[model samples]
Target: MPPANGAWAWLAPGNSWGWSNAGLISDGEESLLVDTLYDLELTDEMLAKMRDAEPLANNIDTLVNTHANGDHCHGNELVCGAEIIASSASAAEMAELPPEAMAAIVAMAPDMGEMGRYFLDCFGQFKFEGITFTPPTKTFEGELHLQVGDKPVELIEVGPAHTRGDILVHSPKDRVVYTGDILFIEGTPIIWEGPVNNWTEACRRIEAMDVDHIVPGHGPITDKHGVAAVRQYLEFVHEQARQRYDAGMSAFDAAKDIELAEYSAWSDPERIAVNVDSLYREFRGEQAASDVFELFARMAALAGYDVATP
Candidate 1:
């Protein structure tokens, strides 16, 4: 659903794993797209809807990827002739896990045991095959200001939190902010990258903005109240994880032991496994990246699936 004014939001149905939201900000013949969908088919459908609702969408002049996540950018190939944009960190991260890698993972799912089944459960619906990874043609750091005809659009970099380079698309004229994966309204946010403080600060920054509609990367369209909820979740998780870390608990055990309280209702509680692992690494001052497979295996365990015999 779209806000009463300003930009229009295109949300995918449920608040599950790969279902993300996109946006369109248009002024006369010029238009800017917030993000794309999970795959070619999904993106094409979104584009068709946008074109029907706003004629300017047929000629989208700018395509701004809020982050490097595959769900937010895998459909870039459908938006032809648009100047694709992303943060420099996001562009680099995009290369780290391309479409081919995802396809390969899906193919190998059958033999990988419980973690494989969990991966399929999260992403099996999306068609990742034959996706030509379309990287951003233009990249920036900090902030970049652009325009959609007469409307002023601001791209604010608030990352090294969710990912290496996450961004928020603020359209001042329209009073809307398209937060990439920064605000996963009502969904449990996983920390692929974190200082935890940075993510909380990003939430505060959004609250301070003069915007009415807040378009999240996943889940429903919301406002500052929704932003506050996500912030509260982050703060709560950080505090809980910190306490467990101080007690010399392993990250996996800490995730299991920590009470979610009110946030237990959120989708994908298994994500707490990843969040605790990240916090534990932070506490240890470990700069090494966690293995993606290992993280998924932990999440699978948390989800009550038996780990494959080694």
Candidate 2:
């Protein structure tokens, strides 16, 4: 359901692993897309829906990718000629993953071959096959004041949280924020880049905004309270993991013992392993950097019930 203002359209994919919700901001003459869908087919669907609403072929003048994740920017090539914008860190992260790597992942499972079948099962049908990468032309580090029609949309950077350079889009006129991946409503929050405190602070900033409705990067369109829920969830996980880390418990060991009593309702509780791992690493050493695969495998092991194998 799109917001009542008709200024932004919310596209909810209605899946656990797919990049759940995307928003489109309209400007009457020309519009701006907040984030593209996860894959080409999904992107095409989103474009079609938007076109139906406005009946304008080229209303989308610019595409602003909130982060570097494939779910938000992979369908860039399908937009014809919309100028893409993102943070410099997001652009850097985008460059790190090749289109071929994504294609290889897409080629697996439910689609065609067997190599990606397992991944497809685990992550759902998130295939970015044959999607061309379009780099961001405008990269800004801090806050950006964008004019979407008469309203001023604030592109605030809250990085080292969800990704290298995470962003939350704020609409001052409507008192609504299109929080890109920063707040995952009713789902497990993935922390590709995090210090825990950064996320907590990001929540604090949103709380201060006192916005009416927050369009999360994934999941449903919720109010300010929903954003608070994710923040509290992160805070609870951080403290729980920190306590076990202080006791000299390993990541896998801590993963089992930690009870997510507050966030038991959200999807993918297994993600607690990764959240604990990231917090444990940060608690161990803020400046310490571990291999991404090592962290992923450890989280996977925890998710696979190896933690309770003992």
The lDDT leader among the candidates is: 1
- Model 2 misplacement above 4 A: 106-118, 286-310
Best by TM-score: 1
Compose the digit string of candidate 2's lDDT tens values, residues 229-280: 8888888888788788889998767987887775767776777767877787
lDDT of 1 by residue, 1-310 (tens): 5573537999999988999999999986799999999999999999998888888899999999999999999999999999999999999999999998999999999888777899999999999999999999999999999988888899999998999899999998788999989999889998999878899999999999998888898899888999999999999999999999999888888998998988889999889989998988888998787988888888888788897411
* TM-score of every candidate: 0.98, 0.89
- Model 2 Cα displacement at 195 (Å)? 1.2
Candidate 2, residue 60: Cα displacement in angstroms equals 0.9
| lDDT for model 2 | 0.74
Candidate 1's C-alpha runs over 4 A off are: 4-6, 308-310
Write down the lDDT of every candidate, Cα atoms only: 0.91, 0.74
Which pairs, if any, clash in model 1?
Answer: none
